[model samples]
Target: MDSVDLQVLAAARRWAAEGRRFAWVTVARTWGSAPRPPGSWLALRDDGRVEGSVSGGCVEDDLIARMRGNRLGGGQPFILAYGVTQEEAVRYGLPCGGTLELVVEPSPDPAQLEDLAARLGQHQLTQRQVDIASGTVTIAAAERGDALSWDGGRLITVHGPRWRLLIIGAGQVSRYLAHMALALDYEIIVCDPRKEYGPGWDVPGTRLVTTLPDDTLFALEPDARLAVVALTHDPKLDDMVLMEALKLPAFYIGAIGSRLNNAKRRDRLARYFDLSEQELARLRGPVGLAIGSRTPPEIALAILAEMTAVKNGVAVPLRDAVAEP
Candidate 1:
């Protein structure tokens, strides 16, 4: 979930705790150009106040009007559709007659929402199921080991910390990578034991760790939402942490090197670390797409683009072997 969802949920909990009644609405489905995607949520107070948004403004306005007239109350959930016609679409600012579907559940059990918040605080992906007939909700643990599964009956809300990037070096390339990753809402940590690089390593919203790379990995205990990149090109600094990260469930593991250097590194890993072919294959040496990136920023962009693709479960195409003239 995003920050907006967190805020709305927190508000809902506060309202419920204060003995105020509110309804929770979720945009469960959309066709064409809905303002918000599925899983977008809104909380409506008893007096027609709302947090978050499902459409531009018209939908909220219409919902509020209904609420004031006492037509949308009681403790039951119902599905609503809007913008089925061009005029309605224009009125709601939906592009090209787009339609949106919402699930409105009144007086949601605050305890269940609070439980979800607690799980999210621990950085755990969770799935919440609401029985339409019984109006009961159940929360279950979710895994990032595989692609997200969308169940028609269950509202799967991913609850966790934002994605993270751990760069094992704090050089120029690391700075570029950190900047790009932050724009993508990733928490970044750059580690370097070298005092020269460590002294000037300051990036906003990025933590700088001057500890040894191996110890840093142990402390982090990286999970599937974390990606580790080794940009120092030093075996002493990079190899140990690479081994540690590979042992964990980090979604992307990569290192910067030439093809010849990568081959040598793999040989060393196989000889000393007992890494199998499959395990070694997980290490993307000569990291990033074959974009002919020669500068620090360009290379960083390529690496982050590749990481994003992997996180989204998309395949990276092999670059053409034919050299460009």
Candidate 2:
């Protein structure tokens, strides 16, 4: 689940606990170039209050109108389809004839919502299954590779922290990276053993560790859902982590520095660490794309962009885009 989805759950829990009449909407499926993906949630109160999005801004107007008029839900779960025809698509503001299928449930169980939110807050992956015939929601353990599974009868949505980012420095760039990654629903952890960097380090929704980068990297043993970025320019801190991280199954492994410095770092790793050619190829130096970024935030954006592409299995060319030191 995304942070936005978590927020929606929290809001829904609060509203239900307050005895407010509300409807829970989820993007059960989409066809063509949909604006929002499946499992995106929206909570709408009887008074037109909303908490999340289903199609960005395309299909909300009609939804709110119908829900406010008590057209969507009463005591039974139901489905709503938008943009069934080309003219309907245009009229409803769906882009490029996109279609949205939604699941609307009225007066959901507040205790269930609270349990789901708490599990996600603790970073546990959970699957939420809604049985349309019975209007029941079941919680189950979710596997790492599980996606939103919807048949005509049941809607199964996976929620929790699905991605982890391990940053090997507590510097300014790492700060920006951690901040930006949080919005993208990544669990961020920064590891720096230096006492100087540890004293005043603080970032909301992120964890900072004082262990050395090498030890930290080994302990994580980063899996396919993890991305490792080395922001410290020092070879001693960055190289040890790289030497270990490159051999792992992590989706992304990158080091931050000038191209010249990265090249030297690569050569040194090859000469000293006995990393194979294939292993060396797995490392992304001068991390991120060709964005002409100069500031820390801009650079962080570029790094995350590349990481996202790699995570989604998109082959975007780098073209040697690292910013010059």
Candidate with the greatest lDDT versus the true structure:
2
Tens-digit per-residue lDDT, 118-168, candidate 1:
888777778766656666667888766432333445454556667888999
The 10-residue segment of model 1 with minimum total lDDT is: 316-325
| Candidate 1 runs further than 4 Å off | 7-22, 30-37, 44-72, 83-99, 109-111, 143-156, 318-325
- Candidate No. with top TM-score: 2
Report the Cα lDDT for residue 267, model 1.
91
Itemize residue pairs with steric clashes in candidate 2.
none
Off by over 4 Å in 2: 56-58, 218-221, 318-324
**What are the TM-scores, per candidate, against the unseen true structure?**
0.77, 0.91
List pairs with backbone clashes in candidate 1: none
Q: What is the Å distance of residue 25 in model 1 from its true position? A: 2.4
